[model samples]
Target: MQTSVIISTYNSPLWLQKVLWGYFAQDRHDFELVIADDGSSDETREMLAAMAPNSPVPIAHVWQPDEGFQKCRILNKAIAVAQGERILLTDGDCVPRRDFVEVHTRLAQPDRFLTGGYFKLPPNVSKALTQDDIAGQQAFNAFWLMRHGLPFTSKLLKVVATSPFDEWLNRLSPARPTWNGHSASCLRSQAIQINGFNEDMQYGGLDVEFGLRLRHVGIEPRHIRYSAIALHLHHGHGYVTQGMKERSHGVKENTRHNRLTWAERGLSQWLDSSNRATLLRDDRLTRF
Candidate 1:
């Protein structure tokens, strides 16, 4: 089946370039790339425009004004024009492995949704050199394996080797990945039929909520462990200190599409907001 990969990008031009190149290097060439430029201020759009004409696959860009960091809006918008049975979604800052698309295609099934893998740096990454995205990915991968390998393998790895619904999953197979679905790909219709992502989110918590929603909707997840690796360019610390915390404990600074409402409605709306940058400082809007 034809696959359409949806990338929601902001100001990460360099990372986006690598991701596109990786996708181009894929063994399979039957996919299209759809990107939603959530109003980037950098040379990202220009770079994408210049590169699209000569790209190995069909490249399309849907750009909007500098709204807040509304990833859901862009994803929803891109999916409308996308033409593919399977949809792969990844962050612009992460570079997909050459086999990224191939592994998903081979394992794809009708009732099952794929929960690909991702590796993020430890909480201490902020103190270290988090500037290099690729470096960070490597560091995170090693750290990720050390911490959760046993539990992850015993609990969830088998799904990747064989679909649980498929009899083979019960055979002696390793566990699939548990933590990287943001970089994971899914069937286009499965994602949309579940209403895609919660458009109310901008960043951070969106993925977590999405996982919960997918489970509630009875979506069977196929995990990818060994294949579909990617190099994630560093973007510094996250908005929240820990995944559960609402506010960041570190110094507040200007981030790409940085806004005050990040903890509130999410960076999604703020990035697309007209006065998104200025209005975020408004204390009356704090939901947390």
Candidate 2:
């Protein structure tokens, strides 16, 4: 099935460029790239315009006005426009491995969503990475990362290890495999059934809320943290605030108590004819 890789981004054009380069190097070429921009400056739009023409796969930009940390809103907008049956959601700062898309495609199930993990890089390593490193696939190498000042840790082994041991560990880990926005995939129809993410949420725990809603609707989360890996670029969480946390917590609590299967303010709001006409008139929404 065709996949739509939805990447969320703000103002980090440099990191986004590196992430796109990683997508350009994907071993699987059947997926399309969709940027669910959370109101970035002109720099990001210009960068996308310049790169869209030469991209290996189709590129689309779905953006909204800069309202502080409205990721859920923009993501719903992207989902409204995505054309693929399977939707892979990630961040623009997370660089996927060559086999990332291939693994997700191979493991996709009708009654489930895939939850993956990321090997977080230090700020130094993230700053040092270049498009050439991503294109050559050296950015995913454990030795290469170590040489670039990554501290030696067991988690770093994810970069190079693809053994059955790793798979076993993924399955055995106590951490509940929730749908991480940094690296996750689900059927587009399934996402639609849940009516997309809760727009009431902010930065913290928004992904967890979406995952919980999916489960409320009977879509199991399959753990693929070992196989479908991505490298998360280091960045400050300046957008996260106590107010945002409280709001997100409130939403999660409501979902837990109510067992909410659908978001009240979600993709359907944006998919309506009025919003579509407005988006069509807006120069910001570009499809390639």
Best by TM-score: 2
Model 2: per-residue lDDT, tens digit, 1-288?
A: 399999999999999999998999999889899999988999998998898887889999988888688899888888888889899999999999889999999989999899989999999999999988988989988889999999898897577767686688678767798999988999988888898999988877889999999999899898888888799999998878898898789998899799999888877776765334234344267887
lDDT of 1 at 142: 41
lDDT of each: 0.55, 0.87
User: Which ten residues in a row are the worst by lDDT in model 2?
Assistant: 274-283
Model 2 TM-score on a 0 to 1 scale: 0.95
lDDT of 1 by residue, 188-244 (tens): 656554555556555555554554444555665666544455545557534333522
Clashes of 1: 20
Which regions of candidate 2 are displaced past 4 Å? 273-283
TM-score of each: 0.63, 0.95
Candidate whose lDDT is highest = 2
Cα-lDDT of candidate 2: 0.87
